[model samples]
Each structure stands twice: as structure tokens, then as C-alpha cells.
Target: MNLNIFIITSYSFFDQDLEKLFLCNLKYQDFSKNFKNYENYSKLSSNYKLDKSKHWITNVTHLFKFSREFKNFIKRYTNYYLLNCLIFVSIEFLPEKIASVVLGFISFQTFVDKFGTVFSIILVTILQMSNYHYTVLILTTFYGSWNLSEDLLIPYFNKIHFTMSEQNQWLNTRKGVLFGIGLVYYIMMQKFPLISFIIYSNAFFNMGFLITKITNEIPDNSKSLGTWSITESVWDGHDKFLGESLTS
Candidate 1:
């Protein structure tokens, strides 16, 4: 997957406001402290140097890296150029579906490439879960709640398909009931104090992702991984998960 293209797209999006990158790069501590003027600029410059190192890979330089697997993969898929040409070359035929046409073209490239890296930055931005950079690794991966230990054991559950109506009812009825129970639990949780605090903490943090399910709006596409919905919420919230057995 020619990741140079995705890197360029990430760069272009950030380039829209040049100063924002600089401002966000500044150490919040120093700005709050408001030290001597010259010392502030010098510290900011030093901080910016480290920040650039963190963000540079997301810039133009990630285009090239040594990988024998990458070369062999590209060699095996020599038809991609022809595919790109054939798709765009026939675009004018769909005069009525202009949006669909453009979308088809973009999706073709993105699908072929599997745009994990580009969209990840946007997801991380929305979540505000990681540093603008990865902080520890060379790339921004596993935006939050990731650790080295037991990375493999964490199970991934894909579509255990439920019909939209069943899914909706599960979310609206079951989840709404749990949410009401959760609210009551949260209100009186202070009585037990510590145990209640733990329950409330986990509940509020968890309810962050579940509020969508308590409504009937699962996103149409599931190609994007780890895109959670209310189904997971009710399964956890209401103790009625069918596991991988259920299917649409």
C-alpha cells in the first residue's frame, strides 16, 4: 500500500493552518508559568525541535523505507496502475451520479491501499486519546488504552450479525433501561462511597461509547475496524450478549 500518498494527505490536512501545529507544539506548562520573555522563546524553540521530530514521519519523509516484502507485494500487483487508469478513465459515463463517481474513484484507491494510517490520525484527533504524535513509538498507533502486555490475548469480535430492528430494540429498550438504572446507581453511589465510586467511574466512562446504541443509529459501514455501536453496550450493560453465535 503506497503509504506515501496517505502521508501526503495527512500533511495537507495539517498544512491548512500552519500556526496551529506550532501552537499545539508549545509546552502548556511554560505558557502557564509565563517565564522570562527570551527564555520562553528559547524554550519554545527547543520544544518545537522535539515536536517536529515527533511529527516529521507524518510529514513527507515516510515515503521510503526498506522492506523486501513491500517490494515483492508491489511487483505482484503491477495491475494497480492500469486499474487506477481504467476506473478514472471511465468516470464521465456516470453523468448523473457525480458524487458516486468521485466517491467510487477515491474509495477504489483507499480500498486498494486500505487507508489505516490516514483515517487513524483523524480518529485520534476526534478521540484526543494520544499525543499529536505517538509519544513513544515512531508512529501514532493504538491511540489509547493500548499496552505492550497481553496485546495478542485481547479478542477481536467482528460481525455477529443482528438485524437492524433487533439491534435497534436491544439498544433502545435494553440499553435505555440500563442507562436509567445506571443514573440511579450513579446518584446513590456516594452512599457506599468507594464501591459506588468505582461503579460510577466505570459506568460513566463506559457510557461514553454506549449512548449511540441506546438510540437506533449504527453507522452504515463496518469496514472501519473498532467502530463501536450500542450493541456492545447492551450486551455488556444488559448481560444478553449472544457472542459470535448470532448472525443476521
Candidate 2:
């Protein structure tokens, strides 16, 4: 495999967008003992300016940032992490082709997407890390299918729902809209064999459905807060415990 291909595939498909974030947001203070090889890199000065004094500082920064982000992602999104882990473990037990198909479909989800590249890299790193192998093919296929579903199909479905609900009384319910959307995919798969891969996978559709299920589980008042955008200041109730604010 070419160096460029390995780097692109590993960084883009495998790491998701984490590698990009790590490279872009690296601060000068990142060269501490948290990173394996850079224990002494930043110890000399607390106020050192970033420059090319050391060529390998960026590489060390990548490792430190990756470690921190990976831990934080797993901690804050524990359920999402566990689901991806389960999917990864399933790859070992299932047939190679079947596992690849499932992995590709699951990669469409936001949380699983981040670890997809990492998982792909780990699979091939020991024996043929540089080779552009089946892992790459499977992940890229899944990622592409996911993109098509999200960018094209879901928006189309939403439009159809809105149009039909406005024109027809019978097609106004949520169930009616869902059924109509599923019917569209079913018809497409039946009529056009070429696009069957995307129609059958339905990765984005499943994600939307799962999220809707979770959203319905939340209590009424809490759901409103969940969707609201917060700007700068945070609210903390005082209840005269520490004296009321003068403005209040």
C-alpha cells in the first residue's frame, strides 16, 4: 500500500474526525508526562513558544491528545462506547463477510463512527497495518452508504412527510409518515437492483428511529431542556442560601 493511502484511510475512515481535532487543537502545554515519548519535551520552559525547534513535538502532541479525547469520549458516552465494543466483539465470532456488513452499517451512527477508524487500524496494525485491505473496503462502503442515507434519503423522506401531511388527511400521523418512508425504500430496492445495498442497509433510518425512541423515553419538561441551546451564563438556584443577587 502507498503511504498516502494508508495515512488517508487510517486517519479519515478509522479515526473518524478525532485525528483532525487532535492535530488542530494541540496546545503548547500538551507535551507533559501524559504523552509517552514527550515527558521532557515541555519541562524546560512553562512559557515556551511553538516553533520548529523540535521537529517531532507535533507527533508527541498527537498521541497525548488522542489519549485524552479517547478517554473523555468513552466516559461521557459510555452507552455509545459499549455498543461499539459489542459490535467489535461480534466481528470476531461472526463470519468475516457478515461481520464486515454489520460493522459497515453500524458505522453510520455518530458514536460508532469515531471508533470505526480506530477499530479498523487495530485489526490490521499487527500483520499488515500498511496494507489497504478488507477493513478499508468494509468501512468505506459503510461510510458511503451512511452518507447517502443521511444526506439524500432522510431529507427526501422528511419532505414527503411534510407534503403528504399537508395535502392528505389520512397521511398525517407519525406512523403513516414512517410507513410511507419505509415503503419508498422498499420500492426502490425492488425496482432498482443496483442501489439495493443502500436501500437494504438503512443505517441512517435506524439511527433516527433509535434516537426517536430514546427521546420519547425522556420526561416531558426535561425533553424541552434537552433541545434548548445554551449560550454563556449558567443558572444556579440560590434560594437565599448564600444571599440573593442584587439584580434579582
Candidate 3:
């Protein structure tokens, strides 16, 4: 598998982007332990120069040919994410299970679109009256946070050279996003909260979305679908969470 990965990665420059990305972000998951010495972390921060290094290689900025155009794309993309999240989170608590109806209507539209709004309100209605989890609901606010963070945090994590502990924290954050959904659901006995967090908090601006697209390889090998732009939908098997609840 390693050789195959190398062969696939080395053959095409696009593959190199993937290898570099995985190595840059996924590979050194544990070096943070050594950095726990504080001195090491300080050295890293100094050497890396946090603020100055915001635009790491292959991020959204460099990837999109037109910054203005990309911003528009991000606005649409973020809206889509926030909208679906609004729906999925809503359905989690609904006793009657509008998942079928919600998903059916949503299936026809991308959340980033205007149509997303129509379905979102409808789903929110279904869940508002059903069994829900407040803890999960509160934490799920992070859905928007995660979405927002993805445009910034995930890539930033990728850019910074991390220590093992730092990497662990990173992994935790990523996993927590998924695990919390399920854990909270089980604990809360299903009664959840209002569906405004994701929508009201971030108003689908192009800035963050565009920021997510800092990378520039035509075929992005870094992560899902060649998009250095953040806010991707992934399947962690362990994290079907609201996705499963809503889709089921």
C-alpha cells in the first residue's frame, strides 16, 4: 500500500500534491509530545511566524484563478453547508422523523443555494417538535464553527509544523466533532435546541470560504475533490452522527 501510494503520488504532480498534503497534515500526527516542553512550541511558533504564514502552499487563495469568483463560490458553499447542517441537526430530535421529507426536498438542492433556505425552515419545523438533545444541540453549534473553522483552522493546522500533543489535540478536535454528535445524542435522550446557530452566526460571506481555497493545483490532491477550500463532507464511519440520523 505504501509503495502503491508512493507510485501513484510520485507519477503525477497532482499526486505529489496529495503526498505532500498528507505528509504535511496527516503524517506527523505525534511530534507534538516533544513540543510539550513549551520551549519547543515557542521555537516552532517563532520559526513558523504564525500570522505571516497564514497563506501556506496550495491553499484556497492560490488554487482559484479568480479570487472574486471563488468568494462567490465560498458564499454559496458555506450557505449549503450551514443549511444542510441546520436540517440534519433539526431532524435528530424530531419524534416523527422528517428525515425522509427533509432529505427528499434537500436532495434536489445544494445548501449553498437559495432553495436551501426553503427546505431548511421546513426541517427546522419538524425537529422543533420532536425528541432532541440539548447538549448535542449546543455542541452542534460547532457545526457552523467547524464549517467556519474548516475554512481556517484545518488548513492552518496543516500549515503549522505540530508536536505530538498538538497533533493529538488536532485529532481530538476532528474526532470530537464527530463523536460529540453521537455521544450527546445518546446522553440527551433526544430533546435538542433551536436551529439558528449555523444560519445566524455566519452569514455566508465569501471571505472565509475563499480563504479555504488557498491551494492552487488544478486537480487538488490535498483533500476531497481537489478543493483546498474547507467545509467538505466526509464519512468517518464512526461519525455518521446527524448524517445517519437524518438520512436514516
lDDT of 3: 0.35
For 145-237, candidate 1 gives per-residue lDDT tens digits of 111101100110112233445444543445334434444543444345546434433443333233322332333344421243434434443
How much lDDT does each candidate structure score? Answer: 0.32, 0.34, 0.35
Error of 2 at 184 (Å): 17
User: Evaluated with TM-score, which candidate comes out highest?
Assistant: 3
Candidate 1: stretches off by over 4 Å: 1-180, 194-197, 216-248
Cα lDDT of model 3 by residue, 1-248, tens digit: 11221122122222233323433332233243222212221222211122224454444444343233234335534564566566666567654355544543443342224336767565545644544453234333434333333332332333343443544444443554433432433233223223222222221222222222231212223233223222222223334444654686
* C-alpha RMSD in Å of predicted model 3 compared with the true structure: 17.1
What local lDDT does model 3 show for residue 57? 46
User: Model 1: clashing residue pairs?
Assistant: 161-248, 213-230
TM-score of 3: 0.24
Error of 1 at 139 (Å): 53
lDDT of 1 at 2: 25
Off by over 4 Å in 2: 1-113, 116-121, 126-131, 152-192, 195-211, 216-248
Best by lDDT: 3
Clashing pairs in 2: 14-117
